[model samples]
Every structure is written in structure tokens, then in C-alpha cells.
Target: MAFDSQWGLSATGFYVPSYEEVLDSIQDDFIARFGSDIVLTSNSNFGIITRMMARREKASWEEQQLTYYSAFISTAIGTSLDYIGGNLGLKRKVDEPAFATITIATEGEYLIQAGEQFATESGYVFTLLKDVVTTQNNDGSWSGMGMVQCEETGADTNVPINSITTEVDPDENILSVTNFEKAGGGQDYEDDETYRERLRMENEARPGSTAAGIRSALMNLPGVREVNIVQNPSNATDKYGNPPYSVHIYCLGGDKGSIAETIADYIAAGITLVGSQQLKVKDATGNKLDINFDFATNKPVFAKVVINTDDAWNVDNGAEDVKQSIADYINELEMGDPVYITRLYPAIYDIEGVTDASIAIGTSTTTLQEKNMIQTDFEAVTCDPDDIEVVVNGL
Candidate 1:
């Protein structure tokens, strides 16, 4: 590492001389080489060239510092961060399609084949994952539950509950189809900071059957965003009805087969797993084992915003801007975090010309509140621009 008037690689790290210092050094060198009597005013050709050189030098040093920082985990970004994660055997999570549980009805018993396509009013399509045979309910209506995935990916497709009412291409036997809950698990490609954090977690995680180790391994799986483990150590069944010496794992995203396989590999032999969804997987010895875990749900959050704005507001886009900002805040919240009414204020005030604002939050539009809405750990809160209603200038 050599120290220089412009820049240096030293003991602490990369360093660069300040603009003023660099300018003075260059001026001194000019005087030494030529003479002090030379004119170097701001208007002079020599002065302009000197300043330009100084600026270019500082910019080059700053770029070098960034390049140096990219080699380490904490300071790395973008593709550099992806490379570090890759070295740890972790690939960044990519975009995922939104999933929905839809109920289909028919006038008579009918086999709703896999690949049946349904849609929302906006024309977003969802394809059924498996075949379902409709049955008569106690009410005498024929219906069955079908799991669907959006034809396209990303969070934009997480439509509201009951919004998937249309059948794409039309089905003669199917009388109606609708989603009971909001579609969820639709996520954009993982961002740099999030990918970097996962890389750090994977680096520190050790290989074992312990809870921490199992969680870390599962988190490394693509499409998996959140994980939770509940252990029942006593001889009696727990409150969630887990048998003695059993474990319950709840995950928000990831492929079912991969999730089961990861659990089978990390969990100790003979530990009973409990969940609604179950699959069989082979362990290290080629012994088949049952792995169970539930897919967590996303609870829809509705918000209402009343704001007073000044003339600076662009009337055409002001309402839209507020809705998007608030929706982003709500959607980014972690699973089980409570939605505070006051927290919505900052998002609204961030919009230009919004002098004052008040907000309300609720699980449903009818039950909105001026305070916070509590959420259970099993569910994540989700919001979209359509879920947020905006009133501008008290109109």
C-alpha cells in the first residue's frame, strides 16, 4: 500500500485526499515546476484545467473505494452481492407467482380438471394446479376447493378476496368460481440487501439437527421467505394438538417437495412432525419418512387515508402516489407484525403538499380503526393500492 497526495491504500482502508487539499497540492507543484508569478485565476485556462483534473482524480478514487468495498459481504451490492451469496451455495430468490385457494361450483357433479383457468375482473389469469371432483354440500350446492397459481409472476397479481370470479375461456359445467381469501406468496425478485443478509445467515449457520440449523437450512431454499418451529417436548398433546415429542413447522413460501426433503435431512429420526400438509421423503439411509408443515397465509389489510393538501399537489397523481406509498409500507411488513394506524401517517405525509393526514387500519374495510390492528404469528399482512382508499383535501 502506497500513500500519495491524491489517494492511498493504508492500514485502515482506502483513503483519498480532500478536494481542497488536492487542489492546493497541484497548485504547489505547478509553482515549483514553473513559477509563482504565473496567473491561475478561475477564468484562466490553467485554473479551469486544474480544477477539472482534480475532480476527475477524486471521482476515480471514490470508484476505487466502491470496488474495494465490493469484495466483502457487508459493503457488497448488486451482482457483487449475488456472487458472494453464490460462494455460500445460496442463489438469490427469484420472482414467484401468486397462489390462491379458489372454490368452484357447478349445477351438477363435475370433474374440474387441472389447468382450468380462472381470472379476475382486470383479466389476470390463474391456472388450477390439480383436478378436483365437485361434491354436494349439506346445502345441496356442488363445490370443491382448488389451488390455483397466477399465469404470470410478481406481487401485482395478489388480487383481493373473491375477486377471481370469472372463468377464462368459459366452462359450461362450472357455475361459478371465487377465491375465499386474498391471493398471496406473489413476490418480486429478491433485492440486493435481502440477498446479502441471507448470505451472512448461511455463512454463520452450522450443520446439525438443532432448531437453528434446521431453520437456517430451510431458509436457504429458494422461494422460502419465513420459517417458524414449535416443539412439543412433554408427554401430553400441546394446545395446537401436537402429540408428545412432536414438532410443527410453518413456512410461508417454497416448493412442497423441497421443503419436505430439507426437513427430512435435518430433523432427527423419530421426531413426529405435525401440519395440515404432509409428504413422504427419504432420509440419509434411504428410509422413507413423513414430513409435515403448513403453508402460512397472508391476511389482507385495508386502509383509509384522509389528507389535506396544498396547491403544490398534482391533482391527477396525488391520490395515486399516497396509495402506492402506503401499500408499499404495509406489504413490506414481516409476517405477524401488527399494523399501527399511526405508522401510516408518515407514508402519507411523505407525498408532496400533504400538510396533514389521518389514517385507519383494519382486517376488513368495515372494521377499520384509529389504533393498531393485531395479527397472529401464523399470518402476514398484505395490502395493495386498491386496498387503500384516499380522500384528498377532505373531499
Candidate 2:
């Protein structure tokens, strides 16, 4: 017979005293109680002891009922929530290394076996995860692609296989080793803010909520930056198999095996459909429903920023930094988010450059064509360092 609109929401009523205020209040109280018996002298041991005691008092109060939410609160709240999630089997994921394929050209017949190692210009060592047979091409030359895994984890390892430090074969002196495509999936450990958001959702998510559970499951995998799930979203054949009632998940920055395993676990019920959208795998007598797992489709966008050369071009006027900053900002954007062409200007100005800048999504042309926004509806958008071009006054 009663109705409450905001039942779940909690109204916070708390205040944290500032450091200075705490000291002043402590001094005021001490003086009031002592009535001029104590002198306000910083040089005195009493003063030092008084301030330390006051700060300790404030610290105890703050720790007990922390109203302010900073990293301190992140650690505080996170510690409890961390335990709660642990009980629920939702542990925070660790960092993961990136993977890439390097095309190694050999002069003579060479077997680029797995475990073979090479270092980049940045001193990052990568190992061949799979063997590549350097067979003769039509020209009778030897070249093969080797799947390489970065030895280190973190975004810094996501480099453009710059150069080959050690030659695969000293005799043939391998023609050259280069990565046409950039390595990806490398990411740092989840920060407090991101981890907090994920923790917020775990408690409220409904059971069998495909969107919530699947996204959480995929995100739990290390290096997975983002995830998007579409369930029989459109009449058109979807990216995953186009089966009716089927869910297609596009994930960014995750290991292939982990992503695949998460998908399998999500659909483990023998009744789980393999390819069909509407029917469960065990329940369906028709074709099997498909559970697909793959990296988020990367829509690479290039930027050409036009800036004053004479005034702006200098050592601090780092064009490279601008490019990397812009690409990092763009890559961090959510999947399916559109890229605003003009938005790249801030990225340019953020650099230590002298002045003004203009941006073009794919071309350096000053004329504004339809290059305003890069449409991403079903895929994640990424910006590699190679895709950005920073020009100094068009010269």
C-alpha cells in the first residue's frame, strides 16, 4: 500500500574537513581549553606534537567515513568491493601483451622456427609464437610470415615492428624484417575509475542478462579495452553468422584464446545455440548456432593537421607527439563512436607548438569534403601512429 520512487539510491550526507581546517580547529580548541596558557609557536615541540596529533585525528575520521572520493577512496571502496566481487568470482584482470605478425624475407632457405626472437628499435624483444616455412616464391625468393608475440605487456609494446635487431640467419643475413600492420591488444592494468564502474554494475545485473554478463565476461579478460554486443539487431545478415536471435560480440584488446573461451562459457549449456539466433544449441534440431569471437573491427582513421611552420616548428613542437596523442585519444573512444574531424585540432594545440591548426580526417586537403566523421556502427575505431600526419604550414 506504499510506493517509493528512489528506493535503491542512497542519499549521502557526510563532510570531510580540510587539512588546514583540521589544524586550525585543533589549535582553536586547544587555546580555548587552555585559555592563553599554551603559546602558538611552530618551533616548540608541543606545537609539532599538536599538529601531528590533530592530523592523525583527522586521518582517523577521514578513514572511518570517507566522503571525498579520490584514489584514496578508490583504494578504500575498491578494497571492500574487490572482496565482494572476489566472492562472486569477478576478479580484476591483469595486463596482457600484444600480438603481431612480422614478414621476414630470407635470401636462402631458412626455417623461422617458433621461439625465435627479435628486438625492436625501442628495445622491446618479441618472440615468434608460430613457425613459418620460408618457401620459394614465384621469383625463387624466400619469404614467410611469422606470428610474433610481444614479450612485454602494456600499451608501450604496441609499436610498429620498427626494425630487426638480430638477423634470423647470419649466413643469408635475412633480407629484412618488418611489420606492415601494427601490433595491438597491449593495454595497462585497469585503473580505479574503470574498475569502479565495472564493480558498480555487477551487483545490479539481471540473471542471464546477455548484454551485462557477456560484456563483463569479455571485459574480465586481460587487455580487453572495450566490448559491444548486438543481438539479432537487424534484419540484415550480422557480422557473426547472421543467424536469427543470435548475439554478435565485437571485442577490442584481448587475447584470442581468452576471448574465445569466454564465448564458449557464455554458451556452454548443451542447449546453447551455435549459429541459430532463436534456438538453443541442444534444443535446436536445425543448423547449429554460431558463437563467434574475434577482435573488434578496427576502423583506422588518419589525421592531417595543418599548423604554422615558422612559428610552431621546433624541438618542443613535436609533430610526432601530436600524432600519438591524437591517435591515443581516438583509440580510447568507445566502439561505434564517430570521429569528429574538427576534434583533432585540440590534439594539435595541446602540443607545445606555437599556434593554430586544422584537421582533415583522411586527407591533407584544406577544402572541407565529406571527411568530417568516420562512421563506426558495428566496429571499434582505432588510430595508429602511421595514420596521422602533422604538417607544418603544408610544407
Candidate 3:
């Protein structure tokens, strides 16, 4: 068969000729045209030329294959993905800084100005979101709460509670600084896999009161991590106490108002919205209607990792590195996704000196889990760096 005829779109799928196949086709043509008497060994100059020609032809076929795949979301990547996302009205999310509330105690009445930087021991810096003026308390000390945002983007800034203890530039009046709650909402730029998934969802999403459509719309919102909608489609109230034809939306990490508004826009009229949290959203006629949705609770996943390492391992930071890696993987999981102990192997092995590792995960520290930790649809697994304990066996 001709080289060109062997590769291209077939009934099965897009196909491309391998390097060896292309070379064989070229040699067969050469022998058919010039007769078998012609020298055709790798040592021969003609054979070398033939091999080079085959390589070039194979490269062209690969490029054509890439072009074909690039038109579809499933296989497209990088700039091609960006192009498809733009056409679908889906812009890739950029990295966002983490934000948390920090408590500032002062020896005397002091003003914690906006832009004052605080840092964790690991050196992640965060700036106060707004000015916080301290008020005198009964004991003559002053304290106030201030919201702060990490100066940098990414998950590393989502430090654990009490991690932000250092003041980047020490202020004499500000006696101490610490975060009682873990900083959250930090995210890396949406990767190709995630972006492609979103594109697929958006492409299939229709404009109507649909579970998939509502979930897709909510997922596109900034800070919205996961969304699950459970509908009681029966004529009577379901076991979950949802009224007839009611939907209970469980979402994690999105503005409550935005969630309410999006639910209002997508939900069909006369359908009862069910949840614990309620927010008033304006309807199309500018009338306010109460919308309800439950914020998915975080199922804190504690892990104990024992790693066998060699001399090549980074002794000082290796444990923390492993902890952070595990935390990152756990935090990235969507709502109700089980915490698979086996899935953490890749993240652990990615560390330079890790030879072997064993991981145990559970919802609480008291109970140990060998099997995957399952969660309800309204729960998302959360793992703080501090929650992950790493032990190096052979450091």
C-alpha cells in the first residue's frame, strides 16, 4: 500500500504511520520501481537517504495527527485549549492567593494598617486586607481581628492555624500576630486536564433547569470547588426531607451570594430549594427570593506517612516536602471524592530520596484507616500540612 494511504482518518479513528512502517513502505516502493538488485542496506548511501525521508514523512504524519486531535477538547492542549475555552466563553482560572482572618494583639491601642505583611515560619507572606484599629480591653491590652491575603498565589500559602506567627516587618506596638483559622482558597492556575474537563462540561451544558447545567454553571464561578445537586424528583417528600421536585445543592468554596444567584437563575420556577444556608437573591423582576444551599463540610483527613529514604534524600526539608505534597493532592480532590491511600504513592515517590513509603489515612487522628476513606456527597476531604505527619525511616 502507498505510505499516504496507510495513515489518516479511518472508520476507527485518526491514525498515523509509525516510523518503521513508513520506512518499510518507502523501501518497498523503491524496490518495486528500481528492482531488487538496487543496494538497500543501512550502510548504503541510498538507504541512509531513504531512512531520513521516512523520518520526515513520519513527522509530517504526526503533525497531521496532532492537528486533528487539537480541534477536540479531549486531546487538545496549551494554546489549542485556550482557543477552545475562549470560543466556549470559558476563561481558564489563574492562580489566586489564599485569604484568612488573623488575630493581632497589641500592647497598647495600635493601628494595624493595610498592607502590613505577616509571614509563616516557612516564609509565606500575607498582607492585611484592611486597616484594623485595636480597642482597649478589660485587662488594658488591645486586640482585633484582621483579614489578610497571601502575597503569592498557590496552595503553599494555605498555611495551618497559628502558622502565621512572624511579622514580616516587626511593629513594636503590634505585640503578636497569628492566624487561628487555616488560610484557604489558594489555587494554582487551572491545568490542561481540568480546563479540558470544564470545556467538555460547558460544551454539553444546556440552558435550562438541569442538574448538569446547574453544576457546570456553578463550577465556572470563581472559588467554587465542587458542586453536587440532589433532586427529590418524586411526587412526595423524599427520605432526605426534600419536598417534591426540590433540589438540594451542596457546594464548597464559592461566594454564598453568587451561589444563591446562580441557583436562582438556573432553577425552574415552583421548584423548592432545600438547604440549611439561605440567601436572598433578586429575581428577573428585581424581586428578592430566598435561595438555599448547603455548603459542603470539610472532612479533615489526617495521614501518617512513613518513608524509607537514602542518602540522596533531603534530610532537613524532606519530611515537610512529603507532607505538603500529600496535602496538595488531598486538597485538590472534589466533593465526596474518597481519600485513596494508594493514590498518594506517586506524590510521595516524586520526592527525590523516597525509596518506599506507607500511608494511613482517616477522618480523625484516633482512628486509623487502611482502606480508602469515603465521604458523603456533601463532604470534601481537607488536609492541612500540619495534619500530615511524615517520618523518615532511614534518613
Writing each residue's lDDT as its tens digit, candidate 1 over 260-321 gives 99999999877888998899999899988988988777678888888888888879999999
Candidate 1: list runs displaced more than 4 Å: 1-8, 98-122, 126-149, 156-167, 170-186, 206-208, 236-241, 311-316
lDDT of 2 by residue, 1-395 (tens): 11123222237534555666667777777787787778767777668867887678777656645433322323436566466557667766557677877888888778777888777866777888988878778998888887788889886676653553455334354777777666766787766666766666665562244677768777767777787776775556666555665565677766555565556656435322332212213223444444554456666676676677544456554778888888878877788788776676677677765377777775333433435665565566777777776667623
Candidate RMSDs in Å, in order, are 4.4, 8.4, 5.4
The C-alpha local distance difference test score for the whole of candidate 2 amounts to 0.65
User: Whose lDDT is greatest here?
Assistant: 3
* Clash count per candidate: 0, 13, 0
What is the lDDT of every predicted structure here? 0.83, 0.65, 0.85
Higher-ranked by lDDT: 1 or 2: 1
Task: Give the Cα RMSD of candidate 1.
Answer: 4.4
Off by over 4 Å in 3: 31-36, 100-113, 118-123, 129-147, 156-184, 232-246, 269-289, 305-334, 337-359, 364-366, 369-372, 383-395
Error of 3 at 34 (Å): 4.7
Candidate 1, lDDT over the whole model: 0.83
Q: Sorted on lDDT, highest at the top, how do the candidates line up?
A: 3, 1, 2
For model 2, the stretches where C-alpha displacement exceeds 4 angstroms are 1-14, 36-88, 99-114, 118-125, 128-148, 155-167, 170-185, 201-209, 233-241, 268-291, 307-325, 342-355, 363-370, 384-395
